[model samples]
Structures are given as C-alpha cells and as structure tokens.
Target: MDLVSTSREALRIGAVSYLNSKPLVHGLTALEGAQVRFDLPSRLADDLSAGRLDVALVPIVEYLRHPEYQLLSSACVACWGPVLSVKLYFRTPPEEVQRLALDEGSRTSAALAQILLAQLHDVRPQLVQLPIGDSIDDVEADAVLLIGDRAMQTSDDQFAEVWDLGDRWCRWTELPFVFAAWVARPDLPVHASQLADVFDSVRDRGVAAIESIVAAEAANLGLEPALVRDYLTRYLHFTLAKREQLGVELFAKHCRELGLVEASRSSLEHSS
Candidate 1:
C-alpha cells in the first residue's frame, strides 16, 4: 500500500522538540519543497505511522516495531556515555523493584530501562505510565524513567539509585546507544537517495552550528550555555555511523528477547 501522495508535494518532516534534537534539525526549515513540524518523540512516531509525516525523527524502538520503515539518514540522536538526559531513578533496590513508571514522552528509553533492569538484575517489573506533565512524585512505583530536558533537570538526592541509561548501556555492552533516527515510510514520492541527502545535509549543518545552537537554546530550556554545550558536545553523538548501527542492532536484539517488539520481522532497513 502506498503511504504517500503520488503527486509531488512538499515533504512533511517531523522532528522532536527537545534540546537534544536541535542539532539534527538545524536549518531544516530552509529545505526546498519541505515542511517541518516539531513534536514530541512519541507523537512523531504516531504521526509517521498514520501517514501524516513523510519522514520523522522517531524513537529507535518505533522503527524496530514497524518493518516497513526505512532508516532515512545517518543523522540520529545517540550517546556514547552519560547522556544526562535519559535517566532511571530507583526508590528501592533495582532487583527489588516491583513496579516501574515510564515517562509518557518515551518509547525507546522506556524499553531500554526495562531491558537494562532485566539484563543486569534479572528483574521484570510491572509497568505503569507517568503521564506527560506529571513528575515522579505523581507516580507510585519502585522506579521511574525520565527522558529529554526534564531528566536533565531532575535531582538525584532522594533516589536510592540513579542510572543514566546511556552510560549504563555503554558500560554493559561497550557500544554507543542510538535513541532515535530519521525514518521514512516505504514508497514515498521522492527518491530515497535524494531525501537522504537532504536529511544528512541538514544534520551536517546543524552539527557545525552547535555553538550557535547552544547560544540560542540555553535560555529557552532554562539551562546554562556551558551545560547545554557540554551536553551536545560531550554527552550526545549526532551521527549514526558503524558503531551506532551496531548499537541499534544490539538494542533490537534485546527488544526481541524481551518481547518488546516483533521477533519474526527484520527490524531495520539501512539506507543504500
């Protein structure tokens, strides 16, 4: 089934509104014959699924779940270590956790939190949703997962244990972790190569303008420019290369083992 229009129309691009995603979407609005929309990571996934978006930066888990999606570009939101934006706070010991509350804004990080807990401690706790705009205080659970800007601002003083999911994954697997990627639905009106180039070009420009991006975004996110700069440069990795691809494959394997995604289908489609 064709998911996109047959006629040439403005490409509908969706991106996350978080600070971590700024580098990937910088100057994207200037693309010829393209329209870009900013949304939550999870919402972007939904929009892509419903054919409302031609391509979107969606959670890696979302891509793994849908066999029809193709990796549209090398641009991705990844982390080598200590991402400082995706965190798990444990009120009780990890192994003893009986209930885990997941942030409504996350799909990939929620799965990662479960996978890490099960792999490291052999625990599979019951899951609960921490609705958008709600905090850990509003959720009754042994542990809570938080992502994006909110996770960075959260304090760890009250938690028994705080885990930066990216750091934990790297320490456990010795590989980088890919959280989200630019994915496109099958059978688009545009050539895959052409669209991929547009996405990659914007990503390169965005990465090169990180300093200016930090300068513009810091005050808006209520973060100091230094911290934002370090977060972008030190904690986050914007390109999805060989190591990052390995990370995605490994994550898909874990998701399969844990029954988080369909086990019978190939989970990724790399761009040619």
Candidate 2:
C-alpha cells in the first residue's frame, strides 16, 4: 500500500490563506488519493461542520468547538512563542482597553483575545465583531486583533502596545500555541484518512519551498519576500509536538474557562 493516493474521491479540506500556511498546502501534492478544497478557516469550519469536508486543516479553535473532529498524527500549524502573524494592536494599555474589533478571517483569535483579557488580565473588554475588510482604525474599539496575511502587513499606528496572542499565551501559561491543526470528523470512514495523507505531504512540500512561497505570496501581502521567508521558517512552526501538546491543553483550558467548550483533554484526543 502506498502512503499517498489510494482513493479517487476529492476530500474537501480547508486551508488558511496566509503564507505561514504555505507549507501545509505545498505538502499535499504527494497525496495520490484525495482532492483538496482550500478556503479560509472560517468558511472551512462552517462547511466541515455542515458535512462538506472529510478532513481539513482548520483553526485550532474550530477543533476546540467541535469535539467531533479527530486530530491527525504529527501535524499542526503551531508556534512556540510570539507568532507575529497573529497580532493584536492596541490604542491603550491592556487594562484600559474597553472594546476590541476582530478580524473576520478567523474567529478563534477573537475568542482567545476576549478570554485572555478576562481570565488572565481580569478585564471584561467588550468584543465588537467586524468583517475582514473593516479598517481597524475606523472602529471605536480600543484594540484590534488581526490574524493571517492581512494582519501581517497591518500598520502599527494607533496602538500603544502590540501583542502577539501566541507570545502572550506562552508568557502567561508557559506553553506553545497550536494555531491550526489537521482534523477529521469523528467516525470518518477509513478512506478519509487519504485526505490526511494529502495534508501531510503538502505541508512538507510547503516547508521545503518556503523561499518560493514567500517570493510569490509576499508582495501581494505587501511584505518583503525575505521577511515573509523569515516569518515562515523562523516564526511559524508546522508540527504538532511537545510544546504543541502543551499549547493544546492550555488552550483547551482557556477555552473552557471562557465558556467556549466543555470538552476535557482526554475527551478531545482522537486516536488516528
């Protein structure tokens, strides 16, 4: 049996649209069995939960919300510390902040920010939900959390502090952050694992071709190719490992405290 390409059906897979995610999609080419569908995590989660996808690379928060998904082996889009890609720019101190405007690309970051501010900082900041194209400056929110590619190029004006959610989480909880994960619906047929293999392969290819990915996608995001390359190879991580495990547990705990989910670590684990 080959590790790649066994099934003929296309496996609907959701992928992030940022360069940090380049490696994951790049690695899918080695798969011989599944066809993948790529989209922003928000739409992917909606579709996946609606029974449109078999397996997907989705936001970690999505996995947190849906206990019905099983995580794939040895793969995640995580970062040990400061993830420059997921940043929260503020116009006031963390304590003084009253409201937050969220980027629409990923709702997970918004949830994380609200919970972190409340639990860790003991501040009940109001959350103002806004779509992706909404200008952070125009919003009356004291802070704005932006994620993925659009966030990477955000101008640093009108904020007193810049916080990377990943870094803040690590500092507060001393664990790495699993921003995204490869997950499958619970009781998914054995054939669905074909999509899992596709995700793994493309992720490897993406990692190997970071230079090319940055060269191609950076300009569109208004960041230099070299900077994007550094962020991919140095700032971002592509594995689901030790620190990532800690991140998942910690994140799960935080989510629970925020009333986002009630699932425990033991219950969240899906044997692959």
Candidate lDDT (C-alpha), each:
0.89, 0.73
Which 10-residue span in candidate 1 carries the lowest summed lDDT? 1-10
Tell me the spans in candidate 1 whose CA falls farther than 4 Å from its real position.
1-7, 263-269
Clashes of 1: 0
Model 1: per-residue Cα lDDT at residue 163: 97
Score every model by TM-score.
0.94, 0.89
Give per-residue CA lDDT, model 2, range 156-181, as digits (tens).
76579888888887788887778777
- Native-to-model Cα distance after best TM-score fit, residue 67 in candidate 1, in Å: 1.3
228-268: candidate 1 lDDT, tens digit per residue: 99999999988888888788889989999999998424434
* Residue 124 C-alpha lDDT in model 2: 76
Top-TM-score candidate index: 1
Question: Highest lDDT, which number?
Answer: 1
